[model samples]
Each structure stands twice: as structure tokens, then as C-alpha cells.
Target: MRETVRWRNAVFAVFFAMGFGFASLAARFPTARDALDISVDQLGLALLGISIGSIAGLSTASHVVARLGTRAVVSVGVVVVGVGLAIAGWGVEARSMAVLVVGLVVTGLANGITDVAMNLSGAANERALAKPIMPIFHAFFSFGTVAGAGFGALGEATGLGMGPQMTIVLVAIGALSVVVRPRLVEQPIQPEDHVGFRERLSVWTDARTWLIGGLVLGMALTEGSANDWLALLMVDGHDFDPVGAALAFALFLTAMTAGRLAGVPLIERFGRVAMLRATGALAAVGLVLVIVVDDQVVALVGTALWGLGASLGFPIGMSAAADDARMATARVGAVATIGYVAFLAGPPMLGFLGEHLGLRDAMWVVLAFVLLSLATSAVAREPRTASGAPDPAAEVRP
Candidate 1:
């Protein structure tokens, strides 16, 4: 149990670092845009680098973890994130879009590798505790985003540029990664659990996996759209300055943190499907308010709802994918690959649409996906035991 606790804490640190590193870059979207002097559509094209790299990483993460173990993949991936940030910062400072795209690709690939590894770690820990603690792990992630966004806002308010801000932040993340890597309790794959490559790939063909992936895709777009574009939306759609826009983005992250912190109890009571459906409704209403209300304060409120609604979808979907421990790694990787398409790739597509329709209206596409997730929420239900009772191990309680 003590080792389990340490392992969980290590996973938390990894999640936190990942969030902080990603948001440190995301919070500078406006600055990156201005620095590159690119149009919205052009910026979207550049963001495509992340999508391309993330897809590659997600598709291959299981193999990488199998070869290197979760501990090495996660630790090395975090360090790679720092390297990518350093390059991205230089690119922004140099005002070279090509350099920035290269940096983003590197960052996305590292993020993809770390994401699957950490979630696999978290799910394993959750099983050990015999409680629903995945959301708490994700809450720490949101906490990291809150801190990163706050720092970015402070840096912007103090007239610091993206290059210097990320330089200061990435060093801390790199150090944290070094410290936590050793604390991870690497779970060795048993011979009975070992599967051939073709067998591993078979999870991708499962209909239920795709259905869960669909749900994750919608919620991922909801959360990631904000991560990638909320600040810019505040500037372009709502007429806020860069500093104020960063604050609004911070506000969204804070709400997400709160929701995730509060999620385990709610999930323990209501179950994943109901929670997903309810959150989807809340996210849709929030999007409606943000798009149609035309009030900055209302937009801010809508942003909070959006964050709350998106808080659990990815984590819960991950938990569902890992319900069958024998196939956990493969299924999680497959689902993550599908979900990341929305998280990483969808934003650039939205940027192109925003160039034509306006940023506010492009959100309607996100809303459509949210509804799709809600409609497919049933797929997240826990699998029944052979005796027909809900699996006791899957019951998450205090």
C-alpha cells in the first residue's frame, strides 16, 4: 500500500508536469500568432504539426512502453517535452513559422508518448486502491494548467514574451520529471499476459472500443479546443486584450480543476454514463451561451460550464478502456489515438472554419461532437461479470 501510494504520487507528478508544459505553450497562442504574423488559417496549418506527430506517437505508444517500460517512456517523454519547448520558444523569438511547426511536432510526439503511459499508470494504481481515483489524478493535471496559465498571464501582464516565459517554466518541469521517474513502480508484463503484435492490434477493430473513442473524441475536442484556442477566442471573438484573454483561459482551467476534484464522489454515486450525459448537456448549454449571448461576462460563465462539462470525459473513457486488464494497454492506446484526433487535429480544422465563419461560430462544430458523445455514453458502462453482476472491482467508492 505504501508503494502504491508512492506510485500514485509519481503518476500525479507526471500528469501535472504534462499539463504545465502543454499549457505553458498553449497560453501563448496569441503571442505565437502575432510573432509569426500568420492568418488564422495559416496558424491552423502550423498547428497541424502537433496533430501529425501526436497521431504517430499515440499509434506507437503501446509498443514503446512495451519495449522501454512505462517508467522510461514517461520520464524520457517529459524531458523531450522540455526540449521541444525550448525549440518552440526559439522559433517564436525568431518569428519563423517553420521552426515553430517543427517544435510543435516534437512537443506533440512527446505528449502523445507520455499521455498513454501516465494513464496506464494511473489506471493500474486505481485498481490497486480499489477506488475511483483517476479523476483526482486528472485534477492534479488541471491544477498544473491553472498554475501554468497563471504564470503565462503574469508573464504577459509584466511584458514578458513567450520565449523567456517558457525557458523559465520548462526547466522546472524537466527537473520534476527527473525526480519522479525513480518513484514509479514499474509493473512487469506477465508471460500469461503477453500478446503478439497482431493480437494487440485486434483491439482497434472492436466496436465498443470505437464507441468509447467516439465519446472521448467529443469531450476531447471540447477540452482541447479551449486549450488550443480559448485565449485567442477571447481576443478575437470577445475583444479582450492578451492579458485579459489569458486570465479568461486561466478561469476555464480553474473550473476544470474544481470539477475534476469533485468528480470522484459524483461518479461513485451516479455512474459514468449518467455523469457523461449530464456533463454533455452542460457543455452544450455553455457553448450556446458563449456563441450566442454576446456578453463577455456570460462568455466567461459559459467557459466555466464548458470546463466543468469536459472535465471527466477523457479520464472516464480511459478508465472504461482499461476495465479489462488483460487488454488494457492496447485498448487504451487505440482509444487514445482516436480521441487525440479530436484533441490535436480538430482545432486546426476549426481554425480554418473560423477564418471563414468566425471563431464563435466554429464552436458549433464542437457542440455537434459533444452531442455525439452524449448519445454514445452508454458504451462506457462497466462490463458485467460472468455471473451477471456488475464487476466488484470496477465499483469506485470512497
Candidate 2:
């Protein structure tokens, strides 16, 4: 296989591993919590280690990209993530928060760095492919998520303990890390062109970027709210069991995966603006359906609708960042900083709102965000010129 193919495969694998890891923990969380005798508060604090490290890692991505090149950062991230799994697995046996934090931070940094590198690489690859392939590529991450979730059940069915199970998973991931190490290409990222670290840093001041960033923030907030609260909402509010409530989220993930995978060709044919506008409307309607109906079946369908509608959020936004010929790379960096914090902050904010207002009412908070997201996406200009050449403004306007 070509080096680039292998590199892309690694990208897919990295996301796949993250998905699987998330699933294993999700499946085993009840047992793990019982075994450790840890409260929700303690677990939250433990999880903070990963979140903190991911935030720190994301903040420094530009310098990392400039210095190490895309391939090295991603490869290092993959290796570090594997190390994290190793630590996390051992920590599970030892029941040590300190060890677990180490693993969390390692995996967090790995994921953070790899996220930036992969998106940039995928965007670059999109240019080479002369079509929109990025949406489908990001869908691989979604596939990993589903596979990992399902794998947890399979692991239990097979009577594989967490230690051996995690070890086997880590081994597979580590081998792939090494195999793809040499496949990544070191290209001068076009997105970073004509933008200095300082100027790139100044994306905070760009109104257009902020417009888009705010939109991204809203999407993440809504999605995070749903991810953290949906199952609980179904169970606590509607009196469903763990399995029944979980089915809602499972449907959401499936719908989201389908939407994003299908979004690829749609973007290529209709353009980003049209896709965003349409999807944005669909999400809005989905939220409304959930709000209006008290029926569980309809609400679950709303969840799927929300998923499908929200599917295009990040990839399409990144496409917009990379739309500018002169500053695609740097803008992506700037946009990422503003947008990523929402992932960290969203659930907490929604929880606070739910506490004050009501859980259902808190979802209404996301309605505002969703509307803002659609408006912000109006600035998602399509790329016309190939490189940073002075041309008709029409070329940059989508």
C-alpha cells in the first residue's frame, strides 16, 4: 500500500481506538465503579485529568504542527494513546487514581494532537482527491464508536476480563501505530499559509471566525447536552430501564453516522452552504419535535433527527476554515481553540441549567445555540481558487 494510504488508515485507526475505548468503559462502568467504590464525583474528577490534558494539548497544536510536521505529531499521539491504554488497564487492576490520571492525560493529549493533524491531513487529502472525502473520513471515527460500544458486550459474552481485553486492544492499536508511522506525508499545510503564529493567534479577533466559532460552540453544547443527559432524561423522566434508555442514544449515533457518511457526496454536489442550511433546519425541527411530544417513540425519533441534523457540524465547519486559500491551516487552529472548549464545558453548563430550570428546559438552551449555529454557518465560504493567488472575490465567496 502507498504510504499515504497507510497514514490515512492510521488516522482511521486512531479514531476507531478512541471509539472502542469509550465503549469499553461505557459497558464496564457499572462494574468498574462498583469495584473501585468510587462515587460519581470521584469519577468526574478522574475524568478531568484527560479533559485537562486534551485542552492543554489542543492549545499548542499549531506549534506542534509547525515544528514536528503533521505525520510526526499524529504518530507520536498514536503511540502515546497506546501507552495511555496500557496505564489505564493496569490502573484498573490497581485501583489507583494517580495511575489512571497518567493514562487519561496520555490518551487525552494523543487524541487532541491527532484530532488536529487528522482534520488537517484529511482536508489536504480532500484537495488532492478533487472531491469532498472528508465527511466520509470523519465517519470512520463514528464507526469506531459504534464498534467499540458493541465490542464491550462481545467481550463480556466471551468472559474476557478487562485486563486481558484492554491488553489485546492496546496491542492491536500499538501495532497499527508502528505500521502507519512511515505512511504519513510531511506537507506544508496550505491552511497555515500567509498567517504567522501571531496572526493565526489573532483569529480570536476575526468576526467571521467568531461567528463560525460561536456556531460551533452551540452545536457542541447541544450535542454534549444530549450525549450526557439523553439516557438519564429517558430513564428519570420517562421511567425506562438502562437498556431501553440506551437504545435512544444508540439510534442517535447511528443516525449521525449515516448523516455524516451521506453528507460527503451531498457537500460535493450542493456545496457547504446548502448542506448546512438544510441540516440546520432539520436539527431545529428535531429539537422542536422532542419538545412538543411526550411520547417516547416520537422523542426517540427526534433524537435520531437531532443526530442526523447535527452530523455535519464539525467537518463542515472545518471545511469552511480550510476554505480560505491564504490562511486555511492557521484559521483551523484558531477556530479549533474557540470551538473545542465547548466540548469541555457543555455538559456542565447544561447540567447547571437543568438544575435551575429543568432538564427538559435545559435542552431549550440548545435551541438558541442551534439557531446561532445555522446563522454562523452562513459565513462558510466555498473555496474556488486552488492556491493563495489574488483573484476575483467571487472565487472565495461560496
Best-fitting candidate, scored by TM-score: 1
lDDT of each: 0.86, 0.67
CA error at residue 396 for candidate 2, angstroms? 12
Q: Candidate 1 has what TM-score?
A: 0.97
TM-score of each: 0.97, 0.82
Candidate 2 stretches greater than 4 Å from native:
1-10, 26-48, 85-102, 153-167, 188-196, 231-234, 245-247, 288-294, 353-361, 384-398
Tens digits of per-residue lDDT for model 2, 1-398? 36556655656666666655554544444344445676533544565666666677777877678677887877677667767766766676687778877877787777677777777777666565455666776677667656654555565456556566667767777786677667666743554334567876776678877777776677666565565566556654556555565556566667778988999778767777788878888888888777667888888888889888878887777777766646665667667666766656654565566556655666787788888888777777564557854233422211
Candidate 1, poorest ten consecutive residues by summed lDDT: 187-196
Query: Candidate 1, residue 219: CA error in Å?
Result: 0.8
> How does model 2 score by TM-score?
0.82
User: Of the candidates shown, which would achieve the greatest lDDT relative to the real structure?
Assistant: 1
